[model samples]
Target: MSARTTPSPARTAAFLTAYDALLARWPVQVEHLTVRTPHGTTRINACGPSDGRPLVLLHGGGATSTMWFANVAAWTAAGHRVLAPDLIGDPGRSVHDGAPLAGVPGLLGWLDAVLDQLGLPRADFCGHSYGGWIALEYALHAPARVGRLALLDPTQCFAGFRPDYLLHALPLFLPRRTAARARAYLDWEAGDGPRPDPGWREVYALGYADFPATRVVTGPRPGLDRLRSLTTPTLALFAEHSRTHHAPRVAEAARRALPEATVAVLPGLSHHHLPMAGAAEINARLTGFLAAPRG
Candidate 1:
């Protein structure tokens, strides 16, 4: 499916300007890379020692690879080589010049190609929101390629979206969607607590209205059997105040389906604030789970 069309030059510049300012806050050296995949040209932001344990990060919808800013510092400090990518067809620099990756296979295919080109045979995987769903599917689809899996408040993995979420987010899909509405919708989701950085928030809203083919390609939810049979050690973390669905309900389903996985909810977190909130705790849980040796 085609997206809203290429963003205007002015709008694109605005996003980059805001994005660059936020990126300057990264604590360590960061390398910007463009890799070829069957799906399109993928933009990746990488840091940490080149020989450290490889860890790939997939950002939630409307959040480009830049979303990892909070966790990348701690993760890299722990000696993880972090690779965060702008999902093809989402906002940021990735270009969807090839045929649309129509189904789940295509989504996994894109990631597969990315790693192949990067010369990584296997690596740990972590994703947030929609990206989490993709990471889960990828781990299940290609278990051997994945060393471990970490999910952050993923949607459509263990439970369907809440009706209220769709109702509030409906304006984002309409042709009439505007930057103001996008900003307001985000404000609604964030409620009283922390939200994105002011500069990055502007960038996200511009991309949300200007970026094309976003929030598309949500394939059917992963099968329960596949989930139950998953052998890859997993971490399923949810937002306590997530508006997407009942957090406890999803956590219960995760326990039932992937009984061996580490599942918990971060207190005071809402859907949008998930990755940015409780950075120290989030970093600890993620680093600890991923760093643990397999039994």
Candidate 2:
């Protein structure tokens, strides 16, 4: 599709500048990698022992892999190899030069290629929002590969978006999405609750304004049969003040579907604040999940 093109040089430079500033806060050595996939060249921020337990992190929509700066440190310190890749089309370093993912299967194939390129047979998967959906999909698709699953206020898994959240987020999804509008929408999502880092906030807004998204492929949520049939261990962390879906409702559905999975509602956080503003609690919970032996 025409949407799978490179971003303007100026846009790339500005977005990278802000993205890197937060990335610098990762607190550990990092390696930048470019993996060639059937979809396109996937850019990854990799760190920790090469032989460490492999963990693949998927970033939320425009937030990019750089959004993991807060959570990576804790994981890396615990000796887990973390590879956070910017999704192919959504913006950031990954250039969607190849064909747009044919479908959700196409996206999973792209991830499979990325993992193969990185030399991971299987690994732990952690995702936030859109990223969580991907991880959940891939886990269900190939349960044999994922050791553990962590979802951070993930959207569209067990429940759909709340109308109020969609109403506030409508501008960012429209044809003329801009940084100004994105900033307003983000602020509204945060509300009187905790705000994101000023640096992260800047990059988050710029991602919407500058990067003209080519294709965003979000399919219907996994069917209840697939959710119930899931064999991999899962942890679903919902934001208490999320402007999106009701946390408890989704958590209840998640529990009903995956009775053995751990589900909890984090206090005083919004959906947009995930994997960032709620790092402390999120990191602790994540470390515990990751450190646990696979059953």
Candidate 3:
């Protein structure tokens, strides 16, 4: 599928600048930690202090730990520990010797090793897009270890695919430079600026450049049965204008799957805006959900 094109030069430039600044003043000090999984010692980026309740932030496909840059400070300020790890095969700092786990089981295994190394008895898990899928899988497989689960506009709930993925994939058949330009254009569209730290663009661009095909594809079409069985309290936050307009259906499916889960569609935000444009709202919702007494 050909990449969808959008017109927004000013917005694109602003996003690029903001991203660049973020790279310069990276708030979180990152360390290269190793998790001894059955596959091998998977390298991951661990951040945040050891005093607060551990909150793991998992980034989406093609994105790194920086994806959660907008939320880390707020979460930390709220007295919750944050750990943002770059998905194994992605562009960020995580090292992948062979092909990392492709589906849900592999993702859970990697996360299990990470938690074991950190000595976290149980922690809250938050995932966006593909990361959300991994988070759901982890909670299902290890319900006892997940204090709370939060998913932000995750894929797989609806059978629709994002246009950006199609665009990124199209470049494979084109020349390297053309593919690079195509990716840059798509990245600009995905990012929302007019905010903080202009250096984020360079970091995102580098990540995209380094790992163009970092997406993890699911094995088969698994129904929502597993998600329904989750005993942990779940919060599924849907962006108002997500590419997949199936929020209502997704929420319904989640409700049917896990009757205890709460669903809310965030207003005045698109899929790309949840982390950037709707940071405050996202943080507030998360804080409230985590603070609520368990069922």
Candidate 4:
């Protein structure tokens, strides 16, 4: 399926320039591992220590592990090992040639293979947006392997219906000149400086170009019953300015779904910027939650 609209030349050029600069700054370490899934060889960026408690970080759709750039250092510094893997089909280092595990089961199996390959019996799981959905799926399917779970502005609530993407891309769909200006506006507001790394831009671009299916892989609606069944200690972080207008509703839904879950809303942040905007808070909460004694 084609994108609703083609990216304008100016927008494309701007994106390319930003991407080129990003690659020069943050050079990620890439690893190739094969999973049992039919998707074939999967590539992941394995950062931080291998000896520390394995903390797997998953990024939202249209984003790569680079999204965790700001959080990795803090997480690692706290003595917890961190693993930021590019979702298989996304534009990160991971490759998806054949059919990928689309929904919850597919995601769980893919993650299981990653853990098995790394010789990790279990680890703390944290995901942002789409990653959050996958993280929840893993916890639900393999509760024994997930010591703790953190969901950052995850989707699939409200019966799997959300308009966040439309809102985020609305500016891009404006008039060409207007779109260019809007894009520039975002770049400026986001700090036009080079990204922490260059490869991140490339990875993100690749996902944008190759992984259109990501838009359709929000996963199934676990509903309230499934959410209530999750026994893993969970933390749900919601951005104050989430594109999902029903932020309060979603948060309330999550709280009700996982009655035992720790729910908190970070003020003065949007969906895309939460990973960075709430880095310190997220790190602190995650550290405490993960470090806490588990039954």
Candidate 5:
């Protein structure tokens, strides 16, 4: 099967350039890895000691594993081995020859293949945005494979995307998306920061430019009933200023539904850049949760 959405050659080249440049700046040495699964070959960047407890990182839509570049050291510093995977279809090195939106079964299958290939029976999971949604589904589908779960301003899980956020991002779908327009949209989404490095910003723009909106993976919103029954330990982080969802409502839903969950609303963060913006705070909360003893 061909990819539901494939980047044009030009945009792909540009994104790869920025991606390489960004990865080169990672604070710690990382091992590039690939795992072959039934769905496709998954590309991963591994860090920290081999024998350390496993921690898997998943990036959001229109981004690659590079999303975790700012927080890898914090996770690794906590004596955990980190594995950040470039999710299958959204503008990464991962190959997606099958339908990108195969719903829960397809996603769980791919994740299971990755874990099996890496010899990890269970690992702590931290996901941002779309990655968070994937992590949630994986935990529900194969509860045995997920040890602890952390969601960084995840979208389409506990709450739907905010209307204004959706309206503001509409320009991204225009056939003639330009770098300037894309960057502006990104800046608007990020709201505040030491503006991401120029190269990284361009990479974000090119990645979005290359990816067709139709193929973006928005995981199923398994209702509150299913969420209430989850047994996995979970940490749900929402951005106070996010346009992805009403932060308080999402947090409320998380608190109300998940049996074992801690919901926090990080102040002054937007949906797109929550992971990268408050890296220190986010990492602390994430590693702390992951390090806690399981019941």
Candidate 6:
């Protein structure tokens, strides 16, 4: 509530500059939009053919819409209109009023308002990490508004978070040593992939230092029966080496629970590398899922 912390102006400026540099690498026609919700405002980046099937992309916590840079081109090439919204209460340009969203209910309300303003009654959803959890919640809360769901290493949706994750993350809280610690954590997640680009890495660290930290309310964990009840076409990907949870267990549970869904544990991948290590493979899988005719 009341923004856990406010980013300093200087740090915000630096973050924005680095964000722009990362965005510049991907050249695509985009329409910037602002949607008004009852509680706050959301910023959305729209791309692809105006008449194509609507596909909403949601980025993970601590990341913004720009996180989809690697996947957008593939989605657009598959003839789907893509909309990436910066989750409010994160480091993005979206702004909220007095308090951050109060868990799932607030999140749904904000999303509904944004969709309404975009003139979309229903759309396919693609989300990564925390955003994936949000998409799963949306599918359950407002089933009719979701055509299908694609979750990329979503956290705390299929399984509980591993306790050791916090222990490994403790170094990130230190002020003076945060950057190095953050980079180490990210590197661990990235596995064998080369380090992230300089500009992107710099912005990530700056955002980590400056962005207002907010509570991650992992609302009620739905039972397997609950997930099984949903009929929406679903695709859930779990990283084989994810530090968030036991990926193999989660993948198995997902497959057993959601009989109609396609679930897989990606080999040699982790949460953060979902957008990098096997980006093209993930994009192809997603595009194929979206393109298939629903039974």
Best by TM-score: 2
lDDT of each: 0.85, 0.87, 0.65, 0.65, 0.81, 0.80
- RMSD per model, one decimal: 1.5, 1.3, 6.9, 5.7, 2.2, 2.1
**Superposition TM-score, candidate 6 onto the true structure:** 0.92
Order of models, best TM-score first? 2, 1, 6, 5, 3, 4
Clash count, predicted structure 4? 7
Measured on C-alpha atoms, candidate 2 has an lDDT of 0.87
- lDDT order, best first, reads 2, 1, 5, 6, 4, 3
Pick out the ten consecutive residues of candidate 4 with the lowest summed lDDT. 1-10
Return the TM-score for each candidate structure.
0.96, 0.96, 0.77, 0.76, 0.92, 0.92
Off by over 4 Å in 3: 1-48, 98-103, 162-201, 212-215
| Per-residue alpha-carbon lDDT of candidate 5 for residues 1-295, written as tens digits (9 for 90 to 100) | 2245555667578778888988887899999999988777789999999999999998887668887778999888889999999887667788775545475577777888899999999999988888899999888888888889898888888878778888987887778767777799878876654465576677778777665545454555989778877899999999887766889998998888884788899897777778777888998998889878978
Error of 5 at 186 (Å): 1.3
Worst 10 residues of 3 by lDDT: 1-10
Candidate 3 lDDT over residue span 1-295, tens digit each = 1111222344345334443455435466655566665534555545566688889887776556666766777777777878877666554545555445656667667778778877887999999877887887788788999999999987775345556555654664354433256345445444343332234445554445434343454544346665556788889988765654456666666667667788887766655446767888898889888889876
Which of the predicted structures, 1 or 6, would earn the higher lDDT when compared with the native? Answer: 1
lDDT of 4 by residue, 125-197 (tens): 9999878888888888999999999999887743344565455555543433333343343443234222223
Model 1: per-residue Cα lDDT over 1-295, one tens digit each: 4332355677577777767777777788999989987777989899999999999999888888887777899999999999998888888888887767876678889899999989999999999999899999999888999999999999999999999999998888888657788899888887676775676677678777666535477778877997887999999999998888999999999999998999998888888768777678889999999889998
lDDT of 1: 0.85
Preferred candidate (TM-score higher): 3 or 5: 5
For residue 209, model 5's alpha carbon misses the true position, in angstroms, by 1.9
Clashing pairs in 5: none
Candidate 5 vs. truth: CA RMSD? 2.2
Each model's backbone clash number: 2, 0, 14, 7, 0, 0
